[model samples]
Target: MSAIRFEIKLHSCNDRFNNPAVRSPLVVEVDLSGPRLANDLFFVLHDDTTGRTRLSSRLTGLGLAAAVLGELMLIGRVTVELTDGWVGLALVDAAPTGDTLTQTALDHIIAEPSHRFRIWLQFLARTAYTDVAARMTADGLLHPPRGRLSRRRAPVLANTAAWPGGRLNLAIQRRQPLNLQDGVLLGLLVATSGGQLVLWDQNPTYLSASTAALPAPLQELIAQTEAAVADSVISRR
Candidate 1:
């Protein structure tokens, strides 16, 4: 089948003046595409001053927690996009650290059902901003102590990795049928596999709702793959 694609954008905020009081923001982008497998992205955010690192994963709660922390820490903004068989997430310039809160949230998400993608994304954006604002206040970055700010309506398109020469090992297990909107959740797990995009179909051989309901082009690609695999097996014997 036509290879699926995914992309990621990252932003970071750091103390530029070597003082916790002065923070500078940084932004980055990444893209990945290939066969649907497992563990496609790996993300890390570090607080240089405290030597704290937030290892990111696609666990629903973890993403939200990071977003929340970003808000609290005065981290800028993060944007994620999924389109035409590609998925990507973007962040301003904030260090992401894996902490108890993030881990706990991720665990909770995993235990939940597949219908929570939109909720998770909404939560991520809201919490991250809120956490950043709160953190700024706690760190004396902001005055008057403002509450969580609402996000503007961003574009949501109709929707949509892996690499070698790397040392880290990643495993992605597709335990259930994830709908189009929720597919972006995989991007979170991408952070664990050195930023490699991995998708595991619990029923890899079976057609996904997205696949069964695919456009003609994708359908043709799947047909070609099936034929090719059959040809290979026959020739081997």
Candidate 2:
């Protein structure tokens, strides 16, 4: 059987933070192909202080859906890939060293047994620490919590039952053009995933004090979408 090889790439771009000015955006790429291959990736970004996430993404295939769903039910962990061939996974924490990619980091991510989605989310959370620092230099008021460090052990799905509570109420405005059902789905995902989710509300007055500190452009974008959705709902009535 052939091995399912995984490769990762990280890119950085200059932002506002830095003495002479040195910052960059980080991008990650993952690849996998093999017999009976299941490729599922999940990314999560959390604010250290609130233990809440600003964003999350999931990628996966069909065969493993049962396992993934099972894991989510029991522990929120899913099996990302299972091939008769050799399997490989990679993790790259790009922020700390700047322009550095290490094989050891990749080796660690591959060795984990948790679903690919969880691994990706963990990687994003870890890397965000450095990314946020760089972001702060450009906008001091745009502060989010730093990412947390996982213990050096095998990765596992987080237990939603034991997760912390969320202070922010996710209000999906109808104006964003998102279907009411779809908006509800997003809310359900976040609620079930535990308290790490926050809905993007366009009303500045509605935003939490913490999020309100972000740049005006970002604030407007968040609100405009929500407002659009809200208006849509009103029109139907």
Candidate 3:
């Protein structure tokens, strides 16, 4: 599939912190919208204090790729199709999602509908990392490393630590009900098997309950992604 073109623009915002002090704005519009999976994945993968990410590169790659699929499913651009008892992903729409990475992924699937979820998952996992980082960079969320062996820098949440994943995890940990979007987000994270890594310390039973509570559609999607990740892992082994 061809590349999905990303549009970046400058956006101005005045507030920097909770102190109400106005600071010079350095915001850039990444043109991201509506529960961006890449952003959420980046947030989960990056650690704030040590200025590093805990997830292995392979896990991070697959997790981000699965997040893209979850995003597509959430936006109604794709669905799982059962054909002769065999399940596969089917594209619902071929239109661009404005986010280049998403559109490119859709384009790939549209170009080859016969490809199973595992293939797409592996493809995206290997290829989408650069675009994901690029999006975060455009958003001004990633910070340059102060001093490091590797030049890779950690991402900083602009306003608060409560990113979408954080919020969803928080609600689940607190035994609060999840809305549809949150449910889907949580399902995607669970699929990545990076939920524990993302949320830090949490009870296994509560996590299980949270997963169990997701809607059927989301649960199916999660199952598909988890299978895809497993297949990718096995193929590498």
- For all candidates in order, the CA lDDT equals 0.30, 0.27, 0.62
Please provide, for model 3 over 119-150, each residue's C-alpha lDDT reduced to its tens digit, 9 standing for 90 to 100.
77778888666667767767777766456556
- Against the hidden reference, what TM-scores do the models get? 0.22, 0.22, 0.72
Q: Give the TM-score of candidate 2.
A: 0.22
Best by TM-score: 3
Cα lDDT tens digits for candidate 1, 135-175? 43343433432245632211111111113112122222333
Candidate 1 structure lDDT: 0.30
Clashing pairs for model 3 are: none
Q: Quote model 1's TM-score.
A: 0.22
